[model samples]
Target: MEKGLLYPVTNAYREDQKLDGLWDFKFDPASEGEQNGWAKGLADPIEMPVPASFNDFFTDKDAREYTGDFWYLKKVFIPQHFAGKKVELRFGAATHRAVVYVNGQKIRSHEGGFLPFTADVTAAVNLGEENIIAVKINNELHRDALPAGDTVTLKNGKRMVKPFFDFYNYSGLNRSVHLLAIPQGNIYDYSTSYEVSDDQATVHYQVAADSDADIKVSLADEDGVVVAAATGQKGELVVKNPTLWQVRDAYLYTIRIQLVKNDKVLDEYADKIGLRTIEIKGHQILVNHKPIYLKGFGRHEDSIYAGRAFDLNVERRDVNLLKWIGANSFRSSHYPYDEQVYKLADREGILITDEVPAVGFKMAAASFLGGLDQSFFDGDWIDELYKKHIDQVKDMIKRDKNHPSVLAWSLCNEPDTSTESAVPYFTKLFNDSADLDPQKRPRTFTLNEDDTFETSKCLKFPDFYLLNRYPGWYHKWGYEISDGEAGLRAELDEWQNSDIDKPIVFSEYGADTEPGLHKLPSIMWSEEYQIELLEMFNRVFDDYDFIRGEQPWNLADFQTVEGNMRVNGNKKGIFTRDRQPKAAAFYLRKRWNSLPLDY
Candidate 1:
């Protein structure tokens, strides 16, 4: 069954009770939670809030950098009215891995940290009585996992995570949890695809539910008027004078679906959709048949207190900042973000390039460590990682396929595409995703520095190319700025002359700048240097017509693994961690606000 992890909404047919706020928490360093019966209750546990990371809550080093099993226990009452309904516990996300338990009985387990999962507790919960919900979560990173990393055992026998990527390892529930009371045989999943004509649009929809009932679908305008209606499990709704969803100017239509038996409603679900089409024509990206130039930043969910946690207040602030800076789109870099981010983007008319957590692949991580003697695809680990990678891609698409703001699917970021082995691997991913998504949006992956136009073998799989180039910052530093510009131009000339006919997007390019650091002539790590670097990149970008989008490295400074290369964290953001503007922020704001949407 193609059941989607739909956002639990409280409506006439459903009840959603929040299981957020404080929960009893404790660390199980020895992994003895199951043996010692900690699932029944956590002994001497401390209060930890749901939807927040536990890393920065304490001042001690061990607590902040812990790597082991941690448990959270919450007691909730199951109302007697829900006795005949299907009771389930839905988690927005659990970092890395999680296993849920109800009344000391294991319910369900899930891997991959960025997507939602559920546990059917209808048979386990005591009706009209208090029930214990225990969740055991682990935050270990290994080469076989997504966002690959290694665990180092210190001499003291404690474990520490040595991540292949640059980001810090922050773990927790990270998002809200809820207790849902739904009808026993309800709408499990639904999908919508659009076909726009000159004046009319046809929306094709498919629904999966209990086979005993009949399905009815309707399309409505914002004014509470039904535009089209159909009766069946699968059908099409035709509407006249459709308003297509646009970048920064959105118009959404509501799709209400009902499951009926004998002319009476058994269950119903309502969701908003924007009727838009995204495609690539020649060297341009088109949304609703018009070309668009994407202007935004690659942002992280990290914040002052909420390290990678899903906070609506923080999300709203980030969106408002994007509007102020005249950005119409952003990429959820490295991994998928909370579902609320996509819903907000849909309402605000902001575009998104959704990505899975298939980062830090074999070749890139090996290069980062030192050098690899063999091909990246020659290991047993690669086979396991590939299986895990495909699962994440499937789950990510299933959850995010319906969103109009998601214009593309980024399969993986910076894999080892230089080798011939990567061709078949990425080919399978691109081909499979084409069948999985109903919208059939453009698919691509971000390219690293080593995957040059001449060396990359998997470039043909994607509809467009996304490059992460750091010319002045990582290549030519300090006084050698002119050389960096010359090198960048040389590479651009190669791409322009290459046989590839796809559009190019500068997915990442930025310099790390201290907030108040300044130099007269613009040295590295200074605010002036960042502005100079951006200007140089923009000049190079304008020289080529195939260059369609420019999204800088980050929107705000974020936490990273401790090293001499990072100053407390990565300082490549145009704003501080608290979302305060840097000198580069104003520079980009002026540039982006003046540029046309189709530029």
Candidate 2:
């Protein structure tokens, strides 16, 4: 495959096209012999693509849900012209744990299911000939794994432990696989720090890699002219007075770092780093010393087709929609999103709040009423959970930290009924945030409509206090036509007078209604009601100086198999599952863009 092409893995039997079918297969149980023995058998194995699950390929329905050890193999012949070149095997993403083997040699092993991993296998392959590559995937359910435990319960009362979230978890090599050719000791990772002041700008650059490599680093202007260059220890380099990147004026500059060894250029990588300062003072988020109100929505990485597979076209479509509606920011809600989304946001000049997928609690009706057990939050398992959570967060930051669009790193979303213990969690997260990027913005969490809860009130002095209030959607009297506006107004007034004196954000506030399912003029789920509710909130938001932003309940409708009244899961999205816009979308677009009155 080419360097940057995106391929998706899907169920081979389904109508959805899949690329995983082209792979070879095997099954290696924990009781099996050494991993090397399996690696040796890769030359002649059952051929299948990485896009399929064992259940998808087998006739037995019972095996469809089986989670255990499985081996996948594929063979590719290297071109003679690419001989002696540094070849890296890159897996866009995999689930749980994966170990890669090349021609009977274990090359690399990676943990964490969401982030990308690569292994340099140039020495293990024979150029100009067929090479056998095998990958071992272990999908066993472990309580220590992130998003652990059974999320969905079956009608037969059988509970299955899976990576449960609001959307479907389509496991396997669900992303892309590629073989990239580069020189040795190339750019492994790079960090860019911009110090912008009134008169001048300075940029600190750090690059990491293998020993004593001659690295050439330079910053280029918008017109592609070199502005600065420096050579330093190991692979570190710095460039000062680089052109600063700002919002609105958004002056962007590219830093090109080339790795050379023995007078031959090995690898070259370029990054677009933005130089600007962000500060929050007196309920205002200032970028480059100017107050900017954020109008945005929370988004989940789910498509009608591909499940969690990353699609560049789909990401671009979502960003275009946000831009069309005059949105300047996005919240990667519930979990961390694909790196491509963050890159697009930086290029398009949108503010972002990247979140870690620490969304706890069982969402069943019985579980909701009974509430999450406090014991679940306490134990030795809690430490492992926090470690896994922090690992995921660090991986996300490492991959997307250079992008200026990211404004804050949200620790977690509505961590189950916040208690005094929650304070320590946030405190630890705050310390971690400082360790990762001290110059970046602070971290925060959201407090939904449970003000009476001590945990909610105690989180007042946090970096930012976000409220997810949907007065007309969840209140007892919300269904009544006469009480809708009055109830919302009263709630807003009460919240404004609360003891918390920090930057406020309406993190979530939208009603779920099936698209094209129009109701009479008086119903809460009606098209008229959705638009009216948003307008009422917008008016109230305009009057409040403390509320710095408002992200509607969701950007698009996502999957929830647990059937609800309106539709499957929450239907409260401006767009449908297939990404069709609702009638209320136009009103929001007009209001956000400050377009002429046309309602």
**Top-scoring candidate (TM-score):** 1
C-alpha lDDT of residue 80 in model 2: 63
* Residue 515 accuracy (lDDT) in model 1: 93
Per-residue error at 379 for model 1, in Å? 2.9
Task: Encode model 1's per-residue lDDT on 95-188: one tens digit a residue.
Answer: 8999999999999898888888888999999988999999999999988888887788899888888777788888999999999999999887
Superposed on all Cα atoms, the candidates' RMSDs to the truth, in angstroms, are: 1.5, 6.5
lDDT of 1: 0.88
Tens digits of per-residue lDDT, candidate 2, 360-449, equal 422221232234445334445667777877777777677667778888877666554445555566567667666676356757766656
- Worst ten in a row by lDDT for model 2: 9-18
Ten residues in a row with the worst lDDT in model 1?
363-372
**What lDDT is reached at residue 357 by model 2?**
62
